[model samples]
Target: MGGGRSRAALVAKARESIAEGSKSFTVASWLFDKSTRERAHLLYAWCRRCDDIADGQEYGFRDGARDLKLDQASAKDRVEAIRILTHRALDGQPTADLAFDALGLVAAECGITREMCDDVIDGFALDADGWRPRSEGDLMRYCYHVAGAVGVMMAKVMGVPSDATETLDRACDLGLAFQLNNIARDIWDDDAAGRCYIPEEWLVEMDIPPGQLMKPAYREQLVQLAGRLVSIAQVHDMRARVGAGRLKFRQRWAVLSAANIYGAIGKKVHARGEAAWDHRVRIGFLAKMGHIASALKETMRGSYPPQLEPKWTRGQLMAAARMAGPVAGVPNTPLRDEGVRRKED
Candidate 1:
């Protein structure tokens, strides 16, 4: 693959990757301007590739016939491979993999640092270590590493100033909300895979034992917990909306549409309870379109007020981010309110 051809191939591959892997995101991305949409697809390709590599799945679907084992040693090696390739890509070296090259392009265009990439990889490391959350804080920290950090990077890719710490924090909050919804919706599938993300304390309070979450007796308790997760997601989703208001109209519409779509998944999960996992919860195409319409309306109205206190502080979230390393150039400033507010205020 020569220079120009290779770049074109990489971009084509990225578009295919997103279309195959995430229908919701693919649909929402259409709202972005051409340049932003293409770059977002590039970023998504890299992210989807990393996730597939970590889970030993192809586009998130497992080959159940194969004897898939969760060997920590092997997982570590895979993580290392991901890191090496990613670093080479970040260094502007040829990695041969379109996903890595896409990452490099996005990094260069967005000023994304190695530290941000490392933060996302650290989430994979936790999975490799067979980590399970002991408390709400532990779960939220995991969420930050895996999803919130990516949100920050996405915000940067969308041209949010690096110095806009508050807006970035809200972006992180949206990712947190998305992951919480994912955890709630996938509890059964994750347990079947010999993993669980809900806090052990919550399970114990409900009198359920580890690895036995799917037991029929615990359904009610699990529903209550899922509801709690959705409630938290709702709060963060609203705060994220405020942050979205700061972007250009088209970008704002896209962000709000994504938030509504993901938030709808959480709401449906909460509504369905244990039955949510009986069949994977998803927002239908019609429901997604409805959200997109609402997003457009919200963008036009343009009235996002500052939020009340968030459950967690920006300092706490930043500390979690720093667990991987310094967030390159992000200031270590304290957030004014628990929630994100407009910069003008």
Candidate 2:
């Protein structure tokens, strides 16, 4: 949209990426006005591309995304590639990839920042390094980079000003909530991938040895830990709902619908107890519609609770991320792909 391609063409591709990558988000996006919806799609395209490259997938679930494998060397190189392209996009240099160019368009329009993009990239870097959370705090920090920062960017796309810190915090809360539900939902798949987000301390506390989380004898302990995770998600979900109440009616409707839909997944995981992982947790089309209807009704309900005591805030998380230092050490070189151009469009 902002580089060499026509806006219409760029939009079509971005829309396709979202339509293919995430059903839940694609459905929720419909609640926004045309402009907001398109910008959201554009942002999601870049995020999806980065994730796909890092994981050796296409979009997210299609093209044998699950079956594809990424070794440590490939993972690191891919993460670096994403970082280079993102910086190129942000600097208004040619990135070649349509997704990164889409990021340039929306970022130029909405004041999305370098720090915001960096935060999201840091998550991919962590995954590339095979990093595991050692504490509950570490788990949330990973969530903040992976999802919370995306929430902040989404808030800006929906017209929340850059300085709207409180609203942005709540947006980040929504992202944290989404990631927590993901952690609860994807535990089995994550184990299969040789990645686990469960804090080491929690595993130690439960006497579940490393890599034995899915063993029959440790199932109860796993359930208990997942229950705790969902409980934490509910708090951030509540805070997010409260923040949604401050948005325009349509925006609020969309945000709350997503919140309700994802909150349901986390709740179901808790409700299922031992059988939680028998199948992947998902809401059907009908259930999604039901949540959409419920969200409209929730929009009418009045004031939130006087306090939402989130254990972590976006400010604190940002500070912690700063302390941890840069995600990459080496400078980015030009891509070897034929599509990558030396000249800016």
Candidate 3:
């Protein structure tokens, strides 16, 4: 198989990866047109693959246990492997991993820069090194590196103009909000894994010792902190809606549906208080269907109320991207030879 045949297989694989890796996203993605939906799946495959590799998990399976031991040397080697594979993929070279090839296809089609992918990889690097945030700003910056960067890439995949900085920043805000929700909901799980995303300063403020978050005595204090985290996520989620308004009808509906699904998770966490971690918070299928229906209504209404001004700026986010490395000078060129010989890193 070659040309269209090969491309179709890659896309099918990517779609399968998304379906198995993230059911919620797979459900929300149905709102996208076929082309955008395929590209989104392709991009998500690369992101998911990178995350799985970094955490030592099997691709497409969240049940795999991660090694809690931090081996800095081994972690650095993995990061290097990700960098080499990603660079080759962006250069239109074949890679051993189909997910990386999908990345190349999406990067070529959507003009995704090396800087954007690097920012995401950097997040994995942080996790591999067992980094812990010391302050709220640090946590937010980590979120930007991981999820916000992915959101920016997704915005590009959605066909947002590269120069549309405001819309792009809002896209980043949405990713940050989604991550905040994850952090709030996964506090116990992360703690069990010897990782903590909650800021050390916040823990100190609550008089809770670092790495002792699950102590029964601090349950109420932790619940209060989770509520605050969800509140912040809500603010950014609303701002993200402002950006969604700028997308096409189908894209807008898809983005809004995703927001509602993830935002609902955070709200449920907040409502459940400390009990949020008693069981992993999940949005049921019926609720997700309802969110999609509501999103469709919002799309038809075609107007979102004004959002509060965001504290984070496009410059700040872009500056972080630049810090990852100089922006690749690759032109937004059309896809070249799709039959490039595969390269192993």
- Highest lDDT against the true fold, candidate: 2
Candidate 3: segments with Cα more than 4 A from true spot: 1-5, 59-66, 320-345
Question: For candidate 3, lDDT tens digit of each residue in 238-337?
Answer: 8788889999999999999999999999999989976889999999999999999998998888646544554454456556445534221221112122
lDDT of 2 by residue, 1-345 (tens): 367766777788899999999999999999999999999999999999999888887766536444444688888998889988898888888778999999988999889998899999998998888888877777888899999999999999999997888899999999999999989999998997889999898999999999999998999999999998998888888888888877999999999999989999999999999899999998999999999999988888843652446677788778777777555333222112222122223
Angstrom error of the Cα, residue 258, model 2: value is 0.4
Candidate 1 C-alpha lDDT tens digits along 159-252: 9988999899989988998999888888888888888888888899989987778899889988998898887777777788888988988899
CA lDDT, candidate 2, residue 145? 93
Model 1 — which ten-residue stretch has the worst lDDT?
328-337
Collision pairs in model 1: none
- Give the Cα-based TM-score of candidate 3 against the true structure: 0.89
Task: List candidate 2 segments past 4 Å from native.
Answer: 62-69, 306-308, 327-345
Backbone clashes in model 2, listed as residue pairs: none
Alpha-carbon RMSD of each model: 4.5, 9.3, 9.8
Model 2 deviation from native, Cα RMSD in Å: 9.3
lDDT of 2: 0.86
